[model samples]
Target: MSNLIDMCNCCNGCSSRRQGYTLKLSFPKKLLVATSVLVILAMVVMPSEARALQHKIRHERRQHDAVALTKDARIRQEELRRRPHRRPALLPQTKDPAERLRNLEAERFKNATRTIQKKLKNTRRYFNEERKVLNETREYRDGMPAWLPTINFVAIHFHTYKKQGATLSERKFAYVIPKLHKSLKEFLEIFDRLYKVEVDFADDPFSNYNRTRHELIWNTTRRLYSTIAEIEENMAAVNVPEQNFTPSKSLQALEMKVDAPQCLKNDYIAFRAYGNLLNNWFSEFKCPHGKKVTTKNAKCAAYEAKLIEKKNKRNKNTER
Candidate 1:
């Protein structure tokens, strides 16, 4: 065993000597190498730990900010909910019966006129197209009959003409309402008949003229019904008795002649002319002249003006 140990030691010495050096570390040198390795490991590990800490801190800060914003929004909404709501101020009630009646009539008349104007505009549009299509037909293109009753608004114009101290009277409403209704009824019947019958155009088999004719009659009929209702309501408000009247014989005769294209054209022209007359009558009757009557909420207007002033001040400050 002693000899085997001696041989191994001799072989180790020979290998070390062949390498020309034997690495040897003292206690201090060993400590220094260990310190360097520990510093390198710390340099790599500390940065990752710091980065993780920073990320955690940023996430927490974002969560804190979000919570703060939510709290602020809740507070604002609560404040708004606690605030009292305000109602708009209204015009004082007028004591004069005549003045009140006048105002009511004026307001109703204005609204009716606006509605009539809108309907008339739609009627005019449809009428243009209807006229165009009708003109294309051989019968209409040939010539309208001279004996056919053409629409003339001269009588309606004379009736609705503005006179001194003129007001909406029961007499005026009574006379106009029945005539308007009769005209509308006649026009509607004509349109209903035409809508069923195909126009004399082989190229327009789908009845394009009938379609436009339908639109014109529909708008005019609506206008007629609306005007009648408005007049009735106004009469009721003013304590005026509603009078019953039949359509005139002339209007009946016109209705009977709807079978002819010339009569249809005349009826359309009359419908449009009557619509214009009604529009003008409503516009001119009991309407305030040169001055507008309006009711404004003083408090609301003042509040709005104050807000605008504050906004302007804020903008100026920001610019500065």
Candidate 2:
């Protein structure tokens, strides 16, 4: 018990000695410690704050891009809705090879008919201009002297020429197209002859009247040749044979003499008559109708059923 009391006394004496001694840091050392703590705090906090700010910026940019894309899509949809909608032509559903061939032929015939009609309109316009020019000119209206022998070629040929029948058949067209071409060619030749004669007989070859007449005939000739070429092309497209025939000797022999006013009048009459004929012919010519393959037909019904079945299968897939 005495040894234990002695040990306790010794521990208290050592603790008192240690408490009496004070450890003090200088100003520089104190400042160094505070700076180190601040540096450690900045390293940890700054990185986390920077990462949060970057993530927010990235998210905002992505949102803006998405909104722009949505706006563009909506604008495109509105534009499409505002535009006129054209229904796409449905392809004919046919099983027969013969029917397909006929369909193709019918399409070609229709295209050719449309093109010919357009060309015929141009031809009629040219003829009308030519008629107007002839009517307005005093030289064209002057009568021939009563003593001279005159021939009315317009009366002889205009009515007698083979005209288009009420109904135009492909077989008849084969004959008629070539005849029309030949007749137009003859008319062109006659106009060219008349043009030369007018120039030769004019007091001043470069006079306004001469120039106007020249322009009128030139236009008429060009349009006639254009119409003839269009007819030939369409005829070939429709598989019509262009029968090769020599020019009519009788028509060729009927020449316009220089200074013959009666010849001009007759020619004008012929031009008007032929113009009427062309308008009538084009109006009458139509594409031949093909046999329709409707849903009522057995083959077409089967084809349409297959299409419907495929469409339903597609719709089912989309729904799934």
Candidate 3:
């Protein structure tokens, strides 16, 4: 009976140990299963979290881009505000090239008229200064040989030849130059005669010799006056091309004919003043017909070509 009881006790002890071991193993298995489940949840939740982070970063980038675009637009607006306002052109834009050209021509003509007026003012000022210089040097005695410079200076300066394709101003200048040349020639002759009487017989008493000299001077002055009057009349409508008009025969005839009274050789300031006075008249004469014009077709093709070249150069510079 005692042996049997001891054996049963041993068996119970073994069974208890086995139960303890199984409980420990079962705890480990449950722990492993819980760990595995947590790993699976982490795998699924981390992807969603990463996607949310990526969405937030993309939204931030878009916002930054929007801000940058707004800042750039504001800067452009400020820059434009700081810039000067451009003035509108006098002429309105036209689709027709001919009409546009006509408008441009009209504007140019208006501007040219103002330029001509300014030139006239400058001419008068210069001539007035010359008159003062001549007056200061007017201390010559009677019978002095007057030193009258020829009017070739006027001829050289004013003469213009026929150019095949010339501007309106150029053509007008050419048309007027011939008449000016003729007038200058006549003026030189008149000046020579006047200088003879005014300088040579300044101190002479009333006598036949002086009277003859005075008469000759008076007649010459009258002729010069007539010539100036004619020029002034012609200038009223100055576009008339004098193709058929002939210069006076007397001018050509008297090219070498000089039978003036003997006089002492001296600088004559009065003659210079007289010549300049006549020049002032010529300077003031405005040509009513020197109107500016725009070409209807490719007449001013040269001007257009130059404009295109200028634009091309500008574009190349911008590229660089």
For this target, which candidate reaches the highest lDDT against the unseen true structure? 2
Candidate models: Cα lDDT each: 0.50, 0.58, 0.47
Q: Model 1, residue 296: what's the lDDT?
A: 50
Off-target runs (Cα >4 Å) in candidate 2 are 1-91, 136-176, 198-208, 286-320
**Rank order by TM-score, top first?**
2, 1, 3
lDDT of 1: 0.50
The residue-by-residue lDDT of candidate 2 on 239-263, one tens digit each, is 7777664544554444545443444
Candidate 1 residues 142-194, lDDT tens each?
A: 33333222333334423553444535543454445445444444445444443
Off by over 4 Å in 1: 1-152, 159-179, 196-320
CA-only RMSD, every prediction: 17.1, 18.9, 23.7
Q: Please estimate how well model 3 matches the true structure, expressed as its whole-model Cα lDDT.
A: 0.47
Provide the lDDT at 310 for model 1. 62
Best by TM-score: 2
Candidate numbers sorted by lDDT from highest down: 2, 1, 3
